[model samples]
Target: MTMNDLQELFVHKLAQQYYVERELVEALDEMARHTTNDRMSQGFADHREETRTQVQRLEEVFAALDRPAEARNSSVLEGLEEDRRELESRIEDDELLNMVYLNAGMMTERVEMTAYEGLTTLGEQLELGNDVQTPLESNYEEEKSAFRELETLATAKDLKSLWEQLTPS
Candidate 1:
């Protein structure tokens, strides 16, 4: 696709988000498997399911636009994933790994939130209507809620203790 107009740009962005959400489904599952903390593991598992739904919603958005659902490669998501792998390789302690996961989860949610925010705004500009806006808004709200939960977990007393213990005095 060429860099032609707003609609094309919107579609490109939407496709990128679609790739992000789809990739997250697998990434979250792996995160859940890696985390020893039960709460964090469960949270990742739950969000994985939500991500699946978000993928479906993105498909709906494509259908509404009369465009075939396609996933544009997201370098942002790729870099984040690469960073995650590098960090995981350097850390062996389970608690510290949990912290990394928590931080990474928060980061991913922030990205998703921003993407959806822009998507919704672009959607409005395109006059795509409720069929498009509703799902995007719902996905955005869910990302916010998920971020709050991860943020809370990141600040919990146990994690704090782990952090304090890990840092050199």
Candidate 2:
């Protein structure tokens, strides 16, 4: 597709995010399986469900736009997933692995947040109706909430112990 107008750019970005969310559902499941901490594993599992809803919301956005629900490849998300798999293969310590997962989760949420922010801004400028705007806003809010949950876990006592283990006196 040619770069012609803001509407085109909006659809392209939306498609990219749709791909990312779809990929995240599987990635979250894998992360949950690999996590040794019960709490962290459950967190990943819960977020996987949320990601599914986010995917559906993105599809709604496509429908509202009267466009087919399609996905563009997101190299950034693919690279992140690759890096996560490589790190998982190399890290053997459960504590350290949990910490890595925490960091990766936070980083992924940040990327999703940015994507939704841009999409919402574009939606407003384009004056898209509530059908499209509502879903994008809902997804964005969920991403923010999930990020905060991970951030809290990062500061919890268990992760503090992990930090202590990594930092020698």
Candidate 3:
């Protein structure tokens, strides 16, 4: 397909998101195993399951668009996952590592939130109507919720103080 219009752009964006969500599934599982805090680990485990559902939702959207469920590699997600892996390996302190995982989760959710918001907006412009918009909106809302939860976790004393220490005066 030609990269000619908003419709194509929307599909391309959907493909990228599909890739991101699938990548997140694996990343979240790894994070769950690495986190020292039980609650934080459970949160990652839970989000991984949600991400699996989201992948199915994306596939549903592809079916609605009468397009094959295809994924385009997302460098952004790959980089985030790689950075998280590297950071985890370098951090010897359990508390610091938990904070790192929390921060990384928040960063990922923010990226997903932005992507879903854009996809929904593009759906509107493309006149794909509610059929297309609904699933994207659902995913957008879930991402928003995940981001809020991650934000709360990041504000936990250990993470907050660690971030403060890292920030330059």
Candidate 4:
């Protein structure tokens, strides 16, 4: 509560966002290894690098305020973690793997986009301008981009001959 200005809350939310994404960075690491598809594995690996930079940006945000970033777990993250575990078990089948990974990746990116947007709005409400806003906005866009990538990959699915018996419609 010590951050009197709204910009501080923006900083706080950014820090919080950092925590969630940091967790995702870890999850994505495991997810990357689980993926048999070379493209999918590489995608996760590349995103992990981006995620590291995002955490560094958050650290800069914290330093600007002379505060150390303290992480608080967002409860919703647990659900994503559990789903990913389930996903690991299901990935042996090509059909299930593609669809499940696409669906799971899309959902996780959505959660991140939602969380990042919430931070951006909170920043705007507090009269925070471009300096604080820019990085958050970039991160938001990254998640959105990931969402689109998964959708594109989803289009390759076939109903028949695929193990899942479901088409990519």
C-alpha lDDT (0 to 100) for residue 142 of candidate 4? 84
What lDDT is reached at residue 147 by model 2?
97
TM-scores, each model vs. reference? 0.97, 0.97, 0.91, 0.81
Ranking of all candidate structures by their TM-score, best first: 1, 2, 3, 4
Model 3: per-residue Cα lDDT over 99-155, one tens digit each: 888889999999999999899889888888777888888888888888888878778
Give the range where candidate 4 is weakest over 10 consecutive residues by summed lDDT: 155-164
Off by over 4 Å in 4: 1-12, 90-95, 157-169
Candidates in order have lDDT scores of: 0.95, 0.94, 0.89, 0.73
Best prediction by lDDT:
1
Candidate 1 residue 142 Cα shift, in angstroms, is: 0.5
- For model 2, residues 46-149, the per-residue Cα lDDT tens digits are 99999999999999999999999999999999988888888989999988888889888999999999999999999999999899999999999999999999
Task: Give me the displacement of residue 125 in model 4, in angstroms.
Answer: 1.0
Model 4: how far residue 167 lies from native, Å: 5.6
Model 3, residue 129: distance off in Å is 1.6
lDDT value, residue 54 of candidate 1: 96
**In model 4, what lDDT does residue 82 have?**
83
Off by more than 4 A, model 1: none
Which regions in candidate 3 have their CA more than 4 angstroms from the true location?
157-169
